[model samples]
Target: MCGRFSLYSSYSTLSQGLKLPLEVAVKLTPRYNVAPGTWITAVRHPTDNEPLVMDEVWWGYRPHWAKEKAPEPINATVEKVATSNYFRGAFAHHRCLVPADGWYEWLPLNGKKQPHFLCREDREPIWLAAIWTERPDGKPGCAILTEPARGVAKEIHPRMPLALDAESLKPWLDPHLTDRETIRQVVHHLDAELITHWPVSTRVNRPTNDEASLIEPLKP
Candidate 1:
């Protein structure tokens, strides 16, 4: 499930591709390996007529109803998101886009898993479907939604982040639309042909290694 990913594209490129404003894009830096718990930029359409805003929030979610000591969750299964008490509120209202150039998955091999980098063949950044909420202290946090993997993603893992295309983005982020069935269908039906992936160096297993080489195809 998109536990690790990359966003090495320059702010200008990401801004242009994602349609984020220059003011917001300028604040982001090149991140080759992004992990949970770190602050991440997310795009939200607050209103139908309003321009999308880019805001930074914690990558993990800590529901307001949970105890302060509860462990934050980085991923939420799409099937349960609409009905889950901890996420229903956010699912109905706080939908967002977690933009990334690509994502990483692992193939279980021996006792270790081999890492792979997956991205769109067109080279466009992808918007991962997500839900966000505010902590009791007013801190904003988000969780990526995962679904049963299909296409290339299924080869490596059984789950992958719920990815949305241009056509699906409008409905998924429509703040006024709160119907669970509509949201589920809009996000679940994605075109698998647009994706491609390759095995990468295992260096990515370490969160500390944030370099371009980490995504390079592993040598035989």
Candidate 2:
């Protein structure tokens, strides 16, 4: 369900990879163990006719109109996001891209769960499709979209974050492209063949264990 992920790429690298303008002033600290409910980087068109901007957004979604007690979900399933009453508004109008190095999934092995890191085979940054909205507190909150896992990711878990192909990023973030069917036609997920996964230290299970070693392959 993409509950944990990593985004340690430098600003320059993310800028080049995501085609972000140099003037978008935002500072980024490398995070190897990003968890739900924390602020995370996302690229979006904040308003009509506005250029795309990269900024931090709380990694949980609760539409401003929802009751204060409404659940703030971190991941929204693609199957229902387009029609769900709680998510359709943001899905149609507040699409964003979450840049990450990779995401973590746990597999039940023996009597315990083993954590695995899933990433692009080329080691390039991945842009996860997401939607955001203004929360009651006036802060932007977002939820990463998830779909049925494909290829190697299916082996790790039944679902995975919807990582977009490079060609789909701009269209996915286009504020004017709000029609659900057209969005489905113009946007597509990254090819499953490009994804790879490997077992990693369980240290990632604890959100505070942020470090380079957390992503390194665990020794056999």
Candidate 3:
């Protein structure tokens, strides 16, 4: 349900926050229409001893088994990803983190969807639980996983992005720890209290608008 999100932080801020190695980065200007198919940054922890690393990847999933031409599925369901063949392979090999300042969901209105902006009161960036893929000849791609919405997210969307913290994220990314019990503990439990929501102007509905006013609170 996290169709759109924002990353207003600078490259160094993100690098420091995620503890990543420096690499050539595609300029990350402020965005308000970060939809599917675009390149995005994800952080990963390869080993317990190594530092977390952030790198850019596409924001969609194209399973190796899919015969269709479409190569990027924007969303993945956490409940079925572990068991589904289309996702199980990537689940084991391509775990990642989708960092964001916040996310956007929409409320159904008179034949239109009105957007709402959600953020942590801390005003800090959050890391979404994500899965990814790497093609032999293409840019690495990823998908944001979803779980049943709770807290403020429930008011706008039935399902919300699966978000994780340092503790839970470690287990989720460790390929060798792929067991039912471990995945169960990380996937089933979540932290929703870290979020707050506000109604925003309908300008966010348009994919072309990338202004700050899109997240501004609507006056009564």
lDDT of 3 by residue, 1-220 (tens): 7788887777777665555353434577777557776777777654435555666787778755565675567888878878787788777766778778888998998988878888877777777888876543455778898888988788889998887765575666665665756677664334688889888887777777878777788999
TM-score, one value per model: 0.90, 0.97, 0.84
Instruction: List model 1 lDDT by residue over 1-220, tens digit each.
Output: 7788888776667667654342363277778789998988887754446666777878999977789798789999977889988899999988888888889999998998889999888878888999888876677789999999989888999999888867787777778889988776765445788888999988898899998898788889
lDDT for predicted candidate 2 compared with the true structure: 0.93
Score residue 60 of candidate 2 by CA lDDT.
Answer: 96
lDDT of 3 at 116: 86
Candidate 2 deviant stretches above 4 angstroms: 20-23
- Cα RMSD for predicted model 3: 3.1
State the C-alpha lDDT per candidate: 0.82, 0.93, 0.74
Model 1 pairs in collision: none
In candidate 1, position 84 carries an lDDT of: 89
Looking at model 2, the pairs that clash are none
Q: Report how far residue 16 has shifted in candidate 1, in Å.
A: 3.9
